[model samples]
Target: MRNDEVLVKVEGVSKKFCKSLKRSLWYGAGDISRSVLGLKNPEKLRKDEFWAVKDVSFEVRRGECLGLIGHNGAGKSTLLKMLNGLIRPDEGRIEMKGKVGALIELGAGFNPVLTGRENVYNNGAVLGFSKAEIDRKFDEIVAFAEMEEFIDTPVQNYSSGMKVRLGFAVASQMEPDVLIIDEVLAVGDLGFKIKCFNEIYRLIENAAVILVSHSMPQVAQVCRTGLVLKQGKINFGPGKVSNAIINYFGIFENNGLNIEGNRRGEIRNFKFGNNDTSVELDISKNQNQPEIILENCQNVFFETSVIIEPSVENFSLIISITDIDQKVVAQVTPPERMFTNLTKMMVVEAKVNSLMLNTGNYSISVHIYNKSNAVDRGEILIGIRNILKFTVKKQKFVGAAPILYESRWKEC
Candidate 1:
């Protein structure tokens, strides 16, 4: 591969599908008639056609790992298929700079009847590996997959995890010019998933990779640039991974795609408390303290945005804090605080001063409500929940709650 040339160039790619099987039948008939007439059907005749992918174009340079992210059926898989040559675009072209090895599906090229050893060679040969090359890398593939004992076993008998491991091992070992993987890491155990992630990162450092995953954290850690896919097209990306994640979720949330169309807004990037030790006041140390008192209730709340139903208007999220006994300690209404209409994620601080309580183990409950009352969501106590817990030590205080104030006696 040249040092400065683009590895893959996708230009004006679009894929369309007929809505129903009946429409597809008509499409076939139209194609036959057009072929016989040495002409094509009028573009208006295919107006009923739905575009699964629309006018998508991008160029991937050599040695760049690009992330493709979207909800299910968002054309991400279709785009990958086009790039892998498994499917052709209805309009436009994809130019590859080198041999493309795509693990588009687990056991995609493996023969069920063939032994693991045979399938490896079969796939390797198809991937343009020489016989000697396959032989040299055969043991390494088995070792990396940790499937040495199953080498002679027919691939059909291997478990799904084993198949994934072997497929990844074989594909990575062959050193393809470009590797396109589609959510393969979503499967497998945690240990194997971590191993796969590390291996993919290593591959990115040396070559180009297109990673597709449902986990945002995984993508944020792996890719520097990402493409967000909307309904059936590559929407927007090439920005921060967090933005990509928010965009990916926004597509569904805006479309009323949640279960039963509950139409609840999303909670993004929630950090429970401050990291400093001083900020994390542990009142638990004072068993002598009669009541569980939260020293600093100021630093607790789930911060996010709220989108109302039907209108989908954005509202600043409101949070209310309660004691383990379901006592409403403090309520922070964003609208009342002059923070009503929020177009994006905004930071809000909730504080409860002078929390009086009888010293005992207590829990915290959280309630989230929209400004319009269209959505009211709260976390119910299953057993004992942890939001904030602090103990009050018995001291020379007059009030039932712990409070300190300077007092002086003067002659009248």
Candidate 2:
């Protein structure tokens, strides 16, 4: 229980992979043959061999959580395996102290033929827990997993979700010195995911937890220290989780705004920032869709900058939010907020205190219109058709409607 205790330490650890199956088998055979003869190959490259993780290093201390983030083949999984001792590093060393509980892969260590209840006891025994200890914790794991009906079923018969639930339940119950969870939690339902999050947080007071995830917000929430990997290289060192997240986003410089039509005004920028972090379109530009939160802890606001040309008027500002399928989730038109006359150039902004939308990406279109006219079908002064987007990431009330907080969205 000393403050200087380091739970997990990975220093200069690296793993290599072969591009061709034939090369991999040949390399394995050569290495095994050399080991039997007490001989070592001096040549480093054996054709098609490349480092999946090269010279990566980090430390996770007790009571601290570390986030590992990157793209699909960023070596995060390989590093996790090294931490769990499932694979040995091609070079360097990994020092891990105390009992480690890892939910690395779905149903990784469980026997397919054994019943869930039997596996629970067997795995606990493998983890150095006595029979009596497993007996005492068996029911709690089952109840937390909500898998009492299938507790007696064979492990092979359980679905992915069921296996993940059972795995997390077991890991969470066991107070290990280190808890490592890869992308396995992404398969579970929303409620279970939230529950597991809370459980992991509680464990943070005593154990060091390592989380590998592709979701930025999830990593930002759980970990204080961050490690970013890209193509087997250390891109960003362990630092503030927030800054690491932005670095991991790989967005630099102002990628021009998406706009269309020769409208009355030139929409220069549509950006958002708050007291904590500011994502300006001029600097860090998001992808096709951005996200918004309603009165969340972070003070977030959206500002629209535009330059009006000459004298253009009698057009209403129409803003519409639609889903991917082009269905109008919410539509609002501020009646009589029309700019009847413009002197030279201007910037107009419509700010919302807070909003609550569904988790999916919602496309936003800003348009200037003058009520339906007989001469023309489209009265768009300037139409940025689905040019920008926002996301509502909070998943809640899954079985019911997605549209909550009706008051936030002014119904047409």
Candidate 3:
């Protein structure tokens, strides 16, 4: 790698955690263990040795955003801690090019007993800032944190949001060469999250960023590259943001979505995909529809699979489409939407009169139910299947909302 090309680099890093009871003891390890073991009902000895991270290595260039995604206990947090220099890796080396600002946990660098002002200065110093420099950015930090009135109050009196706000404000001002953030951003209100994203976007223009978030949309929006960690190693990485997400969800399907013993309804199968990339459809923008020739669009169709649960009675299917704002855009009616008194496989179909959506994104929502009241209804209590999302785009804007396609532009 060239000198100016990389801002942060890690070569073959690994971290492990011990689950031993005696290992955690200081001096009287045997005595404590024997005492506990000799009790009337001795506690079971659980095996130790869990590898949180194994041989993980990747480099991040300056002004690049990297997303770290993994299942719970996938070493994402441990890797982040090592990057922040809070913990040392058991193996391999990490090289950083410049100062780092990290928001690993809420209230990480705060002094509970000290006033907010003091904590700000303390955190600034921890980030290697001088008193004068902290003072210069003090007002901006306080304003951004929205804690001016309580600037003199001790941190112990602050709420979680306040703590996160202060921490984010201070870190935002550090202007470090790299920033490492965990999923704590999911806390706080929606507006705060939006503000944080804006600030982080600005920071990414000058610094390398490593974001660990559970929200897939946030990860896709900010990071150009991502690594999907499975068990303890990097399972996928250096891939397109969308592909990384698909791969990450693949882990869940393999593990999280596995059926346990048995539930009310048994799910047969499912499918997921993007209908079109050119349209870029989401809930807020356009319904996920392909460009229609208006005349040829007598029927614009979306596809989804139908699953029948075991012994479900009077079962039926439901399909719906909602805008990016989650408002219902369209839905297949029951007579045209449902399957009755049948098993095996059912195909769901929806027809649209015309596709007049503006160039935007939209989502498709589907549901399955039992029509107990109807005599011909197939009653089966299978769990609701996954949502199907697609995108629709065009060269020009057609209508204000999806359904308002045939409006006039007369100046009369």
User: Which of the numbered candidates is closest to the native, going by highest TM-score?
Assistant: 2
lDDT of 1: 0.64
Q: After aligning candidate 2 to the native by TM-score, how far in Å is the CA of 358 from where it should be?
A: 23
Residues 186-239 of candidate 2 have per-residue lDDT tens digits of 999999999999999999999999999877668867898999999988899888
Q: Which ranges of candidate 2 are over 4 A from the true structure?
A: 41-43, 251-412
TM-score rank order: 2, 3, 1
The true-versus-predicted C-alpha distance at residue 266 of model 1, in Å, is 20
Which consecutive 10 residues in model 3 have the weakest lDDT in total?
A: 253-262
Q: Residue 40 deviation, candidate 2, in Å? A: 3.6
Q: After superposition, how far is residue 395 of candidate 3 from its true place, in Å?
A: 13
Better of 1 and 2 by lDDT: 2
Overall local distance difference test of candidate 3: 0.70
What are the lDDT scores of the predictions, listed in order? 0.64, 0.75, 0.70
Off by over 4 Å in 3: 1-4, 24-47, 254-316, 320-349, 352-384, 387-412
lDDT tens per residue, model 1, 1-412: 4644678888989877787889889897887799799985555427467877877887776667788988888888888889988877877888987667778887788999999999999989998889999999999899988999999999999999988888888888887778888897566778878887788877775567888998766776788678898877667866655567656755653312112223354332223332222222222232222223444433443333223333434344444445323345544555533334355554555543333433322333333333334354333211112334344334433542222333588999
Segments in model 1 whose C-alpha atoms lie over 4 Å from true places? 1-4, 19-48, 254-412
Q: Which candidate tops lDDT?
A: 2
Write the residue-wise lDDT of candidate 3 on 34-125 in tens digits: 66787331223224656688999999988789999989888898999999888887678999987888888888878899999999999888
